[model samples]
Target: MYGFRFEDVIVDDDAAADDLQAHLADAHGGKARPLCMCTPAGVPMYVAKVGEHYVIKRMPNTGGTHAPDCASYEPPAELSGLGEVKGEAIQENIEDGVTTLRLDFSLSKTGARIAPAPSGEAADTVRTDGAKLTLRGTLHYLWEEAGLNRWYPAMAGTRSWYVVRKFLLQAAAGKVSKGEPLGRSLYVPESYSQDNAAGITQRRIAHMAALAASGKTRKLMIAIGEVKEIAESRYGFKIVAKHLPDFPFMLSEELHLRLQKRFENELALWDSIEDSHLTFISTFGVGPTGIASIETLAVMVVSVNWIPFEHAYDKLMLDALTVQKRRFVKGLRYNLAENKPLACAVLADVLPKPVALYVQPPGIEQEDEDALSKLIGESDIPSWIWRAGEAMPELPLPSHDSASPGSSLHRRVPPRLSAPMLLAQKEGPESAW
Candidate 1:
């Protein structure tokens, strides 16, 4: 029960921290707008000006021994060495490799500036004119019931909390759109009150989405409407240009529209005809396999936590989005003939099975067979990908488990492509997950 709030009303920068803490006491659930300052040293600096500064953290730049997030004079003498705090878990990559997350903080203590950009451009980036407090660290931290981020202990996991929620809600929207829900236990926890439990799962999200467009609920609070509410009480929250935490999740109708736009950008296909030429195109899907949720994975890998919701609404909206980019480098390697494109159907039957096995966003079906043929032959997707799909399944695969095995209740999709195919030739190198 820890979070911050923002005022549509403006206040002096000096009072920001105190204002944040006071608001935190009232809301005490999730975060609102927090200042994001990235230092040149790659250190991401976050500040909540309390009476002075309550939680000061300086994530380290290297691993091994770690420390508290920041320095202070009041207490814990050892805590002064911010990077000296020992984490709860620390497994070295002694063997094949045990990736232990830790904080590595250091002052680049060198010349830095925000460089100038070319003419006509808004401004220069990565410049040296302005100094920045740089910081970057593996965020494997010590957690106590009363620790700062105890509310979200999973911060050390596969997805950032914001990323998890963004994709979780998005996935929920999709499941509900298909007349399915991840089920009550799988969505927004029941602990949520009417005031905050907007739509935790797909069903709730869908219901809430409808209420938003309906003029009847226009008088209600946005979170109350965006989230689930008792007696239909409502509230107002800022609708940022993109995804932001604490703001309620939009319903599936809204979800799909938003997701589709993201996929285009994420899939790197917003300008259907134009951009396709720039990015390697392929049909990817979220498969019904693995225990980790696709919603969680997609959010971590794609949205990086804060979802650009406004962009979720319109395909026209364009910004150099910061999304986790995935490539079939294996796909590119296996996808011989850079001249030809891949098809969705062919990609569906084959291709990206390895990546699929790991994480799929939640909607690819066997029934879309025609889509396979169309994508391979002549369809909406580019021809280069259409051709790539032809050579997709470079190797034979094990049987797909769409049905439940005797003792197993989980259904799963199999690896459609092989390492050999994924290892095929390519013009340039592709990004690894």
Candidate 2:
């Protein structure tokens, strides 16, 4: 609720083994090899940055095509590699008072060609990476492990949904374990998570699944208060572990089911509403409807399908994904200032180009009231409420018709530029209209 502290570790896309191991050693405190598995039995596995291409070795007729479908994957600019990755520890990447971790993940060389079925197999067997990839733009996920439910109570509502989804992903990946999971996060929003942008959010989820399916990024971020730093290196890394507590695991299947059901129900409720809603109040006789309510007939403005969507998801991407219920107001109604940065960001993320919005609230300042009232033809009226019975505007009337031609009451003399108009000449008077 205060603020989040993250110490980022940047991994270059083209980084090799020495580059990665050196950083890991600093983070892992010269562990030579840090533990990379759920149960730390040995030093961590070495994630050697191998060459870009992959070759399938046919161990004597044990294989067929090099690739039944696609060949080597060329990673996009986003996840070709990382700037730096720690050895499954938070303190290794600490900066200031907080800590952070990041990595450039790529589609690993795990896929191999699908060989022909043995001579006379019943069905045409298929062979491909069990995970199916989709063409979505961006995706954001809120996930956690079944074990960590003890630490993060807010996940009680949606634990079942994730557990089930996690189970299915693990089964497909042909691996499942406690403590470790396919997708998870240290900070999961308390309420439902949403992804307004279709492609990006989905792609992000897919990318994470790719890691989980291929057995990578298998690390967890420990809670700060729950754990303590035991040691630190000269290069500012801390050796840490959980400060043991008497309480142990008691996460129930019933609770998990309840949470999953509640999450799904909430998601169904959200599906009922669009991204926007509009409420307008008819004031004075200005609206299309002739009858105006004294309290101003409320006009509800809604952002429906008609509202243009952005190529990338809007702020809604961050908003929709939550683990628990929260008191979040919809739209920017609470924003008092005239300038709308939040609205601007949301619109820019959705709209192709920039859009502008202006809001006019009730009330007028004393200084500009006179000028404003003059423009509205109510110069004589004084006060805030300009009802129908107020006084009308004042206009000058003509004075004695042509009695004193020199003195024009209706038309004031202009400031001199050319020679002034002569009303009447001494000998022969000429009247100018």
Candidate 3:
């Protein structure tokens, strides 16, 4: 278990759980800062009060300093799109335990007749000044803060809509965006139950009361939910989320086409994988007629365990990792373009050091391949590379000191092509989208 130093007290994670509240409370009151003793040089940490509980959070820019096996360890920001807007768009105030975000999109509409500007999925293709968070960047931030980007064998089959909503809400607790608390503007559909349908509806109505308030400017709420389906409506396309069957967000024909064009890769990936989920983060407002219309939105495809993957190859690699019970952190592309190289994942259970996993797409340009190689060479952590259209390489072996050689952790077999991969290959390199 990981150990932490709280002033003169030293405690392991398991033992600290019993008295964590007391220590965190004291830490919040200007007591000595807690240090994670994962390495010879301890990593500084701060106490953040998340709702009713106080938790230890690694200090800003200190994630790479922790040991690979430590829960707080994170691959360097440069390995992901997060490197672009870490301190600029998303500013963390360590003294106050609040993160202030600057958003490129507006939270409220001024004129009733004026339509919102066109916005697309912002996933890999969009480029910005790094001064504000795009819709997809915001989603990535929330997912990362909620700990959904990290996976372990113990997490299998334990994640559900209820858990996702809880963690997302908790992540937004102390976050401030555009001078308003993010929790007030964020809506995550609660898990549905026949026993509490009426109560759920009532609470949802109360929560969205601001959107229907009397004013020239209509307030907008950011909703994050799994897409159940996108069907034709009388006026346009309607998105039906998994939990909220009663609430369908409307999409105009123009926006629908734009969504299809901009996020063709994400949509294609979601369509190709039967068990995968397409998650949407959208800015929507409730009209006077009780209709919810989406203004701007972004989409992402996540695996069965809710870990985001970029393509079919990524999914195949993740499947192998999960099947082998390897612990790893899935990398995310916040605002990075598709051409840029980023680690697909970082293996945490490997011996000697963690390994950064890279999947080179087929027909990649020579310069891009060189850039990817340079990225891998620059990183202190080792890397495992897999080129598309070829057999996958064997995964790095996990530490035998941590687990028996006969255990699942010792199985470092290469991944076989799944149905999705076979389909992608059959359709050619372009179909890997």
lDDT for every model? 0.21, 0.21, 0.79
Residue-level lDDT tens digits of model 3 in 388-432? 879989999978744555432333211110101111111211100
> Native-vs-model 1 lDDT?
0.21
- Residue 80 of model 2: what lDDT? 8
Error of 2 at 321 (Å): 16
Best by lDDT: 3
Please state the error at residue 295 of candidate 3 in Å. 0.6
- Residues 1-433, candidate 1, lDDT per residue (tens digit)? 0111132422222345566455434322323332112111222212222233232222223211111111100111111112232232122222211223221211111122211111111121122111211111011111110121111111222333333233233222211111222122132222223544444334444433322332221211111011111011133211211222333232223333333343344334223323211111111111123111011001101122211211221111111111111111101101011122221111111121311111111243554444444433532222222122233222223224311142111211111111111112122321110
Model 3 TM-score, 2 decimals: 0.89
* Candidate scoring better on lDDT of 2 and 3: 3
Residue 137, model 3: Cα distance from true site in angstroms: 0.8
Pull out the clashing pairs in model 3. Answer: none
Q: Which candidate is the best by TM-score?
A: 3
Candidate 2 lDDT, 189-252, residue by residue in tens: 1112333334433443333332233232222211111112222334332212222121111212
